[model samples]
Target: MNDKLTRFLFEDRAVRGEVVQLQGSYQSVLESYHYPKPIAQLLGELMAAASLLTATLKFKGEVSLQIQSEGAVKYAVINGTHDQRLRGVARWDEGLQELPTEFSSLFKKGVLAITLAPKDKERYQGVVALDKDSLAACLENYFLQSEQLLTKVYLATSLDSAPKAAGMLLQIVPPTSETYQGGDNKDFEHLAMFADTTKSNELLELNPEVLIHRLFNEEDIRLFETQDVLFECDCSKARSAQALQNVAKTELLTMIDEDGDIKMDCQFCHQQYVFDAVDIENIHNDNFDAFNSDGRIDERTLKH
Candidate 1:
């Protein structure tokens, strides 16, 4: 299978970039929920955007890209670690849109939040309202405001026969060493403008080398090897059990009384975990992980 995401350095300049193409991974996230088409596309874009954002930061822990609103789109978020493990989910109101709609339609009005957490250090968060037309533009505004750098991003998604979502980032890094060779800010600007001319199809279909040459043929360029972006969710039954422990005992009993069994499902991967009265009581009594029904996870519950 073709690798889903790849990070590359220009080598000539301080700018570094990444390209993410998602098909199976994107589709798996979409399959987790029956969201509207607009929401699906938004989730795809957000996932790709999150991957690109994580690449920018040489982080050792977690980074989450979240867009929350009280309007049509309640929440759309993607989480990734430094290892490039990614998962995303989106929630929206009724009414299915046949195709990808505008960002305003998906998130009527809301703020974007980016939280970066390092394992042994304090977590950092940045928030900004959706004053721009697209999520891509919103993120670009975020980069300019938070990092105080001139950054540009090109995001494209094709809803055609072969759905592919791709994105690119261009950022200028100030030289830090005594033997520093300064970058021409004006040249970076021109290069970004040229990158802005890229099309969605070209991003999705064309080979990376071809695409780079098409965008920056005039400039000396180098491309790195690709990394796979696989369809994987980190949700598990153990985590669900931990959640059960967190819920109040009264609420757990009420859920069992009302619904026969409490069925909790993970939004990221849509995996369901069902619990009965005995299970709830055990959760309340013991802080242990979990045990199967029939009071046995060993030979007693064994099948004939």
Candidate 2:
């Protein structure tokens, strides 16, 4: 099945919606690590949420959803761009015997943060406490607190065999003209009822068209063109080397002396990058001149 996100608007009500189904992209993320069952499922939901949230971006940069806590699962994060490319990672305590299944139990005193980093403008961040039972609820709370918009989010994941994730979102749109009155609680509630009835199996299996038809066959839904979603990591040797440049030279030299080289592993894609003495020296002396005017590393300079 194609992993895609579909957006739609209700002609009769001042509300918009988004639905995303994941198959290949979700599986690609799981293949990178042997995450525990609960953690895998949580990551899947976060990825789905990230995709849905990124679809709302009006700028040309990336957005990230992160959950941090001092619980068994230390942290989980997913990043996505306006184009729908996504990547995620999760970290947890080692040798934990029991993992809580509920969000409150698993993430005691946790915080959920959404960050928007526009390419040309200032970045914006909004944070909320993880006081809800599910990730979807926490996201809804985020909208309520930050945007003050009546929004609803539904997320589901299945890791039985082939991992997959799906999610749907609905938010009331502000009226633009006198003819277009703002959405009321009654209209939002009526739509939310249908959304709340979505089953995990239906979400993971059905296509967006079929899913929307099944749920809102009575409503006037205007479906838009689907957008593809994929598991994409932006990590590269150049980026990794530039990151090394931020380190103290003495610390890097000590690492090189002890290990003969410094190795860096991308937490998102698990790709390993090795920097030998020559690579380190070249990077140190170039003063980042290896980077071209376009901000991309000149690969030819690293060959020496």
User: Compared with the true structure, what per-residue lDDT tens digits does model 1 show for residues 159-237?
Assistant: 6665567888887765652332233477677778888898888877787777888888877666776767766666654
Candidate 2 accuracy as lDDT: 0.84
User: Which candidate has the highest lDDT of all?
Assistant: 2
TM-score of each: 0.83, 0.91
**Winning model by TM-score:** 2
| Cα RMSD to the true fold for all candidates | 6.3, 4.2
lDDT at 55, model 1 = 76
What's the lDDT for residue 11 in model 2? Answer: 96
RMSD of 2: 4.2
**What is the Cα-based TM-score of model 1?**
0.83
